[model samples]
Target: MEQSDRAYQRALREQLARNELTFAHAPIGQAIVELDGTWRQVNGALLQMLEYDEVELLAMTFQDITHPEDLDLDLGLLQQTLAGEITSYQMEKRYFTRTGRTVWALLSVALVRGLDDEPLYFISQILDITSHKKQVQALQDFTAMLAHDLRTPASVIAGFAQLLSTGPYDDEVTSIARRIERASTTIVDLLENALTTESIDSGRLTARPTALDVRDAVGTAVQAALSAAEMNEQELEVDTSGLVPAVAWVDPVHLEQVMTNLIGNARKYGGPHVRVTTQVHDRRVEILVEDDGPGVPPRFVPQLFERYSRAQEARTGSQRGSGLGLYIVRDLLTANNGTIDYEKAALGGAGFRVSLPAA
Candidate 1:
């Protein structure tokens, strides 16, 4: 061969090697198809994605392995690309693997042309996006659940609130009025917590942490829990013996909500009297809420911070709760660098403790 031809051949060989490596080791699946849809070349990733060996894939056309539901759309886009009306198209499509399992892919297709501007082949890049699709579906399901679960309690509160406002009632009637108000307040708190959690998950909630007097904050939360305690015929007591000047570096509003939710939970599931006590340690401020009711089931302790996770036995018996409260409480505490835990109280019931960094 002439010197010029040898140099040309060497360059061509290097180019061929580069192309082979790019196709075989590309992060995304790649393929080349002729105008008739026959796959002339496929990358290792594409072959692996389709669960097919190179020999098996080489014999099949792109359309043959496409999911039945996606074939029409895929072909339509490919036709558009070939017609020169569009240079490229991207879509979330599905294809069938050798084992018949459907694989989701984000596919981008483009037409490759020769120097004469004639269609040479089609090039495609595919990314597996099944995980993203599943996350979107999960978010949709969560939104639906929130709407349905929240509406029921809201309707109860609205119906009873109007009834209570309509006319004068006897002592018995007044007592029921109080119960309706308490239930309404509880539902409102739940809605707020749900919205707050959504904001936090979406990275929209910003905590305004400040120096807050732990004693005053606990007093405010205790006041909010009083009505709930009264409705349940439970007594709520707050003792700040060692917390007279107790202060913590935290978001006051968030901390108050956490305390109210904890105390309310104790009142709802704990026996008759629930006591909230605050104390200050060397580096942390501790708030302990204890109830006298049946303690939490041992198995449920680990999942206390998970959303919608309630003890089946507790829900079945006398302690039915929406189960979002504790989850929200934990999230709020975590955001503020605080910690909470569930334990069997020395008072013979469930104990929820919140520890915050001292101011």
Candidate 2:
């Protein structure tokens, strides 16, 4: 019996030694904190992550190193975990390093308990994400700069091409100018989508919904799309027979953008004919853009409005798109308290239906 007891003790010691080694040398920052938030134990990775020595970190609470803006949320989650409301919690939060640099981290934490189920300490794992965050910020800044810087030149090119198209040019020159105009217009549209996406991501794009004439908005979009339609040799038509004036409660600018994107997409991807129709249903305004080209494949429909997602056919087709138009349309519609969806078009091709609330 004494030998058996000694063997059991030996096994327990081995288990504890392995656990201690794992805890001390894990790649990510790990810590054990008292219920009151004081640091009880911290690993070398935690010290390295915060640029603090073991003694320095041991003397400070988690709150001392967490970013002020993120402290409340962290504290709230900790409390919930302690109260047994949550078994564990994870979040992306910012921390202040010893050198006063702000860094981001993915933090996962759980509470420890005694045999009697009494709260003991909290264990936390923090994965440094500062580099990833910085990369994302850099990419966004570059995209914004590219979009803004290219807009003027693209617009100028489009304007010149339009003038050339009408300036007594021969058929060959006229055709080339029209092609230039189309390409420049496409660039401008892509830039606009990028800028709008940046605005939405930064919370700068907002909708001011008001009583709007759906037909007028649709008419404006149709007029703007006519040149592109003509270039594509596609017939475009609009039917506003049943749409009541001033029935849509939407931001006029947003509505116009949505319509333009829908019409533009049809011109690019649809068949030789496109039709836009509006109806009033249950006091809501519904706008449908339909094209006669081969409709979107069934499998691609689910991801149609996703940013940067394109159908395989589109990716291989003659027309190149940034794949941002439909995404922007959906976002703008959502901002204006509206919705859009895809369907089989009545014209035997792709269709998009936009619905807006009644004013």
Candidate 3:
């Protein structure tokens, strides 16, 4: 009895869908597609979607207008549905409209059977998603501009301040110079984070892994961040004690950037004196950074590496950050087969351990 009821309900739906006999209209594209990919009937919405006149479209098969890259995927899915392996399938695909412009749409197709359980035709529905795609692209372009316009000047300002700090100067003058460099560094970091985040979101990140001395990379990054530490009235200590230099498989530039970000973030939100230690174990190299300041609140630790996350103390600090630093660092590390972890430091501060595969 249930089987008969289901069959009857299916028949009713097919009847409503076929009401081309009654002049019903749909706001989204709908069509009856023949097994050979030709259109048996097309609604007004489908005609507008393809930018085609009814007379022209009826003469062309669906494959005649699909984007070349998407054609195989669409056909494969259709074959799966027709073979009884699936009931229906929906996918995002592209089409070339009559005017040669590309259209993106959510294309859904279902196999329809006659009362005798034999194939009749397929029902296809298309929802235009081109506008959404355009919105996303526009956002990415604006983000790119934000990164470029802000980072360039920040770099210049940091460079000049670094040069200025090298002079013999009074305590006050040197202090001001240090602060300026740190502030400029912050600007560059935030802007670079924007670009890194965009690359991560778009899956376009590039990594060139090579064997390099990680100890030297850490030392270089620490030297790069010395101005910022000084600006915070903090001392940075590097402990390479008993540490034989190890070659690690990583993108050197990215690893250095991650170290710079880590050191900067530590100096920003943690205590004054910071310690950086390096070690190697079990085919991995570890760089440990710890600060002698207040550790991250236990509650905030779980959210540390999340995008746009900032510690509560950082939110109220004199210098503000864009809250994207650690997130970008994590992404950069993962791209190069490295990893970062945060733990409470035995030095009564926050500790971060970065591990990379030894080359």
Q: Which candidate ranks first by lDDT, i.e. highest?
A: 2
Please provide, for model 1 over 23-55, each residue's C-alpha lDDT reduced to its tens digit, 9 standing for 90 to 100: 889988999888888888898888888999999
Candidate 3 on 91-154: residue-level lDDT in tens?
9899999999999999989999889777789999988999998999899989988888888889
Q: How close is every model to the real structure, measured as TM-score?
A: 0.57, 0.87, 0.74
Q: Quick one: how many clashes does candidate 1 have?
A: 1
Better of 1 and 3 by lDDT: 3
RMSD of each: 14.5, 2.8, 5.2
Instruction: Please report the TM-score between candidate 3 and the true structure.
Output: 0.74
lDDT of each: 0.80, 0.87, 0.84
Please tell me which model should have the higher TM-score, number 1 or number 2.
2
Which number leads on TM-score?
2
lDDT of 2 by residue, 17-82 (tens): 998999999999999999988999999988899999999889999998888889999999998998
Model 3 scores a C-alpha lDDT of: 0.84
Q: Show where candidate 3 strays beyond 4 Å.
A: 1-26, 30-43, 53-92, 106-125, 165-179, 235-238, 273-283, 346-348
Candidate 2 regions off by >4 Å?
55-60, 72-86, 112-120, 240-242, 280-284
TM-score of 1: 0.57
How close to the true structure is residue 274 of candidate 2, measured as C-alpha lDDT? 74
Q: Cα deviation of 24 in candidate 1 (Å)? A: 9.4
